[model samples]
Target: MLFTYPIAATADNWVSTTLLELLKNAVEYLQNAQEPDGFQESVPEEYQAEFARGTKFPDLYAAFVDQCRLLNDQQRDLVLKALAGQNGFPGLFAANTPCPNITVTLQAVNQATRSLFEYAFGKLSDLKTPGSVDTVRARYHQLVHSHIASGCCPFCGLEILEAPDPDLVDPDLDHYLAISKYPFAGANLRNLTAMGTTCNRSYKGAKDILLNELNQKVDCIDPYGDQLITISLAGTVLLPGGGQGPAWVLSFDPDALSQNWRRIFKLETRLQANVLEKQYQTWLESCVKYAQKNGIDISLKEGAIEAVRKFRDTCEYETFPAIARLKTNFFELVEAELNDPQDGDRMHNFVAAVQAA
Candidate 1:
C-alpha cells in the first residue's frame, strides 16, 4: 500500500446523524475512489466521520456525528496509504488473492456499529439488577447480530450459498485482525463459517495454537482473513483396535510445499512411484554387482527389486521422518561431491588423466 498525504484532523463541532447516514457516506466515498476496473482505493475520510460521533458527545446524535468525523479522517489516510501501493497486503479472507481493503472496510463498519449498540445497551444495563447483566449482555449480543444476517461472510473469502450444514450452524463471526484490526470480520454474515457445534467448540480460538505448531509466521488465507491450506490429522486418525491409526494428511493440494523441507512429508502416490522406479533401477545394478562378487546361486537382482518396490509402495506419513533424514544425508553427500577436488574421474576427465599418468 501507498500514501500520498497524512490524514488531516476535523473540526470540534459535530452534528447528529443516524448510523444509516454514516454508512451511506462511507459507501459513497468508497464508490468514488473505486477504480474503473473495480479495485478499491483507501480513504481515511470515513474514519474521521466516525470519530466525530464518539460517545463523549452530549447526546446520542452528537456522539454519532463525531464518531463519523473520526472515521472519515482515518478512512481517508488509509486510502492514501493504500494507493501508494508499496506494502503488499496479505492474502487472507480469500483463496488466491488479497482482499485487504474490502476486509478493512467491513471491519470499520462493524466496529462502529458495535460501539453504537454497546453505548445504547450499556446505558440500559446500568439501570438493571446484577442478575440481569447476563440477560442484558445476551440481548446486546442479539441486537449486534440482528444487523449481522444482512451482512456477508468475510471468513470464507467469497460469497457462499445460504445452505444448512453441520459445519455452518450457529455460525460465529470471525475477523483476521492480525492484518488489520477491522471489526467487519466479527459479524455472523461476514465472518460466519459453518462447522459442527462440537467442532466449533474444539477449534474455537485454535488459531494461536496452530500458529505455534507451524513454527513459521505465515499469513492466514480466508476469503476475508488468512490462508492456511494444510492441517494436521494426527488427532483425527482412528482405528477399530481402540488405538489411533497412522496420521492422515489433508491439503487443498497434496503436492503443496514440495520445496519447503520444514513441512514436507511422505505418502504413497505418483511422486513416490517415480522415486521408486529410480531407486529400484539403482538397486538392480547394486544387486547384480553383489551377486557377481559373492557368486550367489539365487537371482539377487529380483529380490532387491522387490524390496525396493515394497518400500516405495507402502511408504506412509509415519515413515517420513526417517525418509527425510535419509534425504538430508543424501543432500549432504552431494554437497561433499561438489566440494571435493580429488575426484577427477567424477568430473569426466578420467580418460585424458589416465593417458597422461
Candidate 2:
C-alpha cells in the first residue's frame, strides 16, 4: 500500500527525470560490468534475471543492491566485489573511497526501479516500450492507474480517501504472493488490489510470511479490483464546547487477518511513527498550498505567520511561494493554553497554524 498525493504528472518532472536518469545509469553501469562468465560475478543469478540478459551491468547493480541490503544485514560481500570490479570505476574515474561507488550504485538502482514504474505508467513517454517478457506488461500499465483511481486502502481494505490528503494518497495493486520468488501461476497480479501508503509502509519489507499468507488468502473478489465502494466522509458530529469540531470518522470493511498480521502490525506502527508521519506533514503542506491556489478561505495564527515570514524572507524565494499557497483546512491543529481567571487554571487551546502560511 502506497499512499500518495496527486500532483499533475507534469508536476513531478524533476523527480521523474532524475530518477529515470539514475535508473538508466544503473542499467548501463551494470551492463558494462558483465563478465565473460556471463554473470556479473558480483550479482547473484536470480537477481539478474529481473532485467534483460544483454542489459546486465553486474558491477554497478551489485554495488547498489548491496548498499540497500546492508541496512538490513543482507548479502553485502558479493555486492562489494561486483562494485569493486577488476580496475574499479572502469567507466568513471577511479577513486579510493567506495562512497561514490555505493552512492552511484544506489542512485542507479533506486532511479531504475522508479523509472520502471514511471515508464510502465507512462511518466516518461519516451520509455514506454515494455522492457521484459512479462506477458501482462500492457495490462500492468492499465491496472496501475485503475488501482490508483479506485481508492481502496490496500491494507485491511479500509477507505482512506476520506481520511486525509486524498489526492496524495496512491493505491497499490500488490501481489499477495512474491511472484518474483514464488512464481506459481496463481502468484500472478490476480491477487492484487489498491492499498494506501500507510498500509504499504506498514507492510514494507514484509516479504516472507506476509506474502505467503496473502497468497493463501486470495479469493475471487480482490475487493480493490472490483471497486465495490468509494471512501467518503459519512457524517460530522459537533463536540461540546467546540472542541475538535465534528470529529471526522471513517468506516471500512474489517480487514482480513493475515498470518503475518503481527509482523505487519509492528511494521505499520514503526512506519506510522517514521515514514507516514513525515509524509503526513509533507502532504499537509501541499494541501494548504492547493487550497491557497484555489482561493479558499483559510486562517493562521501569529506564530505561524511569523514562521512563514521568516521562512520566506531568508530562504530562496521560489520555494516559499508554493508554501504560501496552501488550503485553510490543511492548517495543522495545535492546542493553545488559556487561563480560567475565576478558577485560576489553564487549559489547552486550538491554534490554527499554517504549515506554509
TM-score of each: 0.28, 0.28
lDDT of 1 at 178: 22
Tally clashes: model 1.
83
Q: List, residue by residue over 182-239, the lDDT tens digit for candidate 2.
A: 2211112333333455555556333632232444422212222232322222342212
C-alpha RMSD of candidate 2: 18.2
Residue 12, model 1: Cα distance from true site in angstroms: 38
lDDT string for model 1 (1-357, tens) is 000101111011111122333344544454465312111122134334343334432243333333444455557555333322212323332223332343346354434444543453333322222324333223333433343342222221112223333354334332223223332222212232332222234333334211324444333323223232322222222121344322222223223322121222122332234333234334334433543454442233333333333333333222233232223332233223323465422422321222233
Write down the worst ten-residue block by lDDT for model 2: 327-336
Give all candidate RMSDs, comma-separated: 19.2, 18.2
